[model samples]
Target: MKLVVRVKLLPTPVQAAALEATLHACNQAATWAAGVAFEENARRPLELRKHAYAEVRVRWGLGAQAAQHAIKKSCDAYTTLKANLRNGRYGRPGTKRHARASGKPVVFRPEAAQPYDDRMLSWQHQARTVSIWTTAGRLKGVRFTGQAEQVEVLAAHRQGESDLVCQGGKWFLIATCEIPEGDLNTHPDGFLGVDLGIVNIAATSDGARHCGRRINRKREQDRKLRSKLQKKNTKSAKRRAKKYAGKEARRAKDINHKISKRIVAEAERTGRGIALETLTGIRERARLRKPQRTTLHSWPFAQLGSFIAYKAKRAGVPVVYVDPAYTSQECSKCHHIARGNRPAQAVFSCRVCGFVEHADHNASHNIAHRGWYVWVCGAQSTAPGLTLIA
Candidate 1:
C-alpha cells in the first residue's frame, strides 16, 4: 500500500522570508489570473486555457515559475468549482460566490512537477537533511528528512488536490492508500462494529465505548470564549477569536485521532474486520435535531471512519460499511425490530425474543453480521433474513 507520513519543515530566517515571498507572489498571481479570466469571459466567453500563465507572468511582472504556479493553482480552483457546479454538488454557475480575500490564497506543490520521481520531492530527504533550490537568486527550502525541533513535513504528493504540511498551523491531511485485497474466506474470528453517536464519540462491538468528554469540554469552553469575545469589540477580541478558532479545531482533531487510534488498536489486537454504519446523510439528518445539534455537529463520524479504514488497510484487516437504517433498533439475537429494542441510550432490550444487550453492542453485532453476510454472498446482500444468530 502507498502510505504517506507527514513531517514539519524547519527553515532559517532567510529561507522563511523567501517562502513567504513566494507565497505572496503566488497570491498575487492568483488574483491576477482570476481577474484575467473574469475579463476574458466577459469580453469573449471562451474556455480559459493554460496559456494564460504566460500572459499573467508578463502582465503581473512575476517570475515565470511563480506566475506559472499561480495560474496553475487558480485554473485548478476554477475547474473544481465548475465541475462541482456541473455535477449539482453546488449552486448554479456564475451565481457561486467566493470572497476575494478569503480562503487559502496561495498553495505550493513540488509534486506537481512532471516525471514523478521519489528523490525529487522534499519528503524523500534523509534525516536532519533538507533540499534547497534557488530561483532568481532567492532560496527556497525543498523538503526535509527526519524529525526537526519545531517543524516537520508530514507528507507531500502531486496528485493531492491541495498541498498539505504538518506544522503549528490550522490544517491537517488525511490520505487514502490502497493495499492488496485480502482473502475473504480467511476472515478473522472476532469482529469490531463501531457506532457513531452524538453523546458518545464511538461505541464499539467489543464492549468498549469512547465518550465525547474532551470534545464536549472543549466545545463548552469555546462557546464561553466566543461569547466573551463577542461582548468586546476590540482588536484583542479579534486576535483571541482567531486563536480560539484554531484551538477548537485542534481539540476536535485531537479527540478524533485518539478515538480512531484506539479503535484501530482494538481491532488489530483481535485481527478482526471492523464494521461501521454508512453515515452519508447523517449531518443533514442531525440538523433537524435542534436540541442535540451541537453534539451532532461535533461528531467526527467521517474522520473516524477514514481513520479506521486506513489503519485497517495497513494492518491487513478488512473494513466494511453497512446500511445504518435499523442497526440500532433491530435485535441481534432474534432479528426482531421494535422501538422497545432500545429502551434507553445505552440499553437494548428485545420485546419479541427477550434478548437484551448494550445498545451499541447490539448495533455492532448487527453491523458485523451484515459484513459477514456480504462476505458470504460475495456481494452486498441487503436481505434482512440473512443475519446469523450467535
Candidate 2:
C-alpha cells in the first residue's frame, strides 16, 4: 500500500515564478490533451504517449515525465467519464444522468498541478534540499521544511512519483511512499470488533467506548460560528470562517489520532485482528432526515477508520471490514434481521431470543462474528484470510 505525506517547500522568488509558469504550461497542455482524448475516445494513457512525451515536452517546457503526467491527467479524465457512462453514473451527455447535466461536451479544466517522477525530483540528505525540474529548463533546489517527523521521512525512505503544487504563494510537495501491509495474525481466542457511530464515535465488542459528545458539541459551535460569519458575506469574515474551518478539522483529526492509537494498542496488546463494517455508499443510503443527514454528511467516520487502519498496520494488528448491510438491525445473538430488533437508538433487543444489549455494542459483536466466520470458513481459512474483514 502507498500513503502520501505532504511537505511544504520554500522556493526562492525566481524559482517560484518558474515553477508557477511551468505549472500553467503543463495544465494548459493537459487540458488540450484531455479534450482531444474525449473527442477521439483515446482512453489509454499510452494512446497519446508518443505525441505527449515527444511533442508536449518541447512545447510546454516540461520534463519527460512531467509532460507524460499531463497526458495522464487528460486520459484519466476521459477514463472517468467513460466509467461513469458505462456504470450509469452519468448517462450520455444528452440524458439527465450526470450530476452536472449540462448536456454539453465534457471540457477538461486541468488544474495547475504537475506530477514528478523520481527522476525529475531528487532529495539531498546532506543539504536538506530537494531538487525539481522547472519550465526554465533548470534543476532547482527547494527546501522541504516543517514537521520534523515528516521531514525525517522525506529525508529517508522516499518513493514513487510526487506532485509539485503552487498555492497561496507557497509550493508543496505531495510525496508518496509504500507502506507495509498488515500480515493478518488473529489471536488464538478471536478477533475484536469495533462499531462506529455518531453518538458514541466508536464502540468495541469488548465493551469499551469512545464518546463523541465533546467533539459533536465543538463541531456544532463551529458550524454556528461559520454560518453567522457567512451571513456577514465580507472578505475578512469569509477568511475567518475558512480559518476556523481548518482549525475545527484539525481538532477533530487530533482526537481521531488519539482514538485510533488506543484502539490499535488494544488490538496489539490482545494479539487479535480488528473487525469493522464496510460502510460503502453510506452517504447516499443513510436515509436520515434533513438535520440528521447534515450531521451524517459532516461526520468523520471515514477519517477515523483510516486512522485506525494505518495505525493497526504499523502495529501489525490486522484490520478488516465486513458487510455492513444489517449489522445494526440484525440481532447479534440470534442473527435475526428486523426493524423490531432495535426499537430505540441505544438499545438492541431481540424479540425472538429476548437477547438485549447496547445497540452499537451488539452491532460490534455481530461484526466481529461475521469477520470470524469469513476468516475461519473461507478458502484460505487462516490468519491472513481475514485481512479484508478481520
For candidate 1, give the lDDT of residue 135: 28
Candidate-wise lDDT, in order: 0.58, 0.74
Off by over 4 Å in 2: 49-55, 91-94, 97-111, 167-169, 186-188, 242-253, 329-343, 349-357, 379-390
- Tell me how far the alpha carbon of residue 2 in candidate 1 is from the true structure, in angstroms, after superposition: 4.8
Weakest lDDT window of 10 consecutive positions for candidate 2: 381-390
Model 1: lDDT equals 0.58
Give lDDT: candidate 1, residue 56.
61
Tens digit per residue, CA lDDT, model 2, 112-224? 55788877888876676888887787655677776776666555656877777765566888877655666655452577888988889899989998888787887888889
TM-score (all chains, Cα) for each model: 0.76, 0.82
Clashing pairs in 2: 320-390
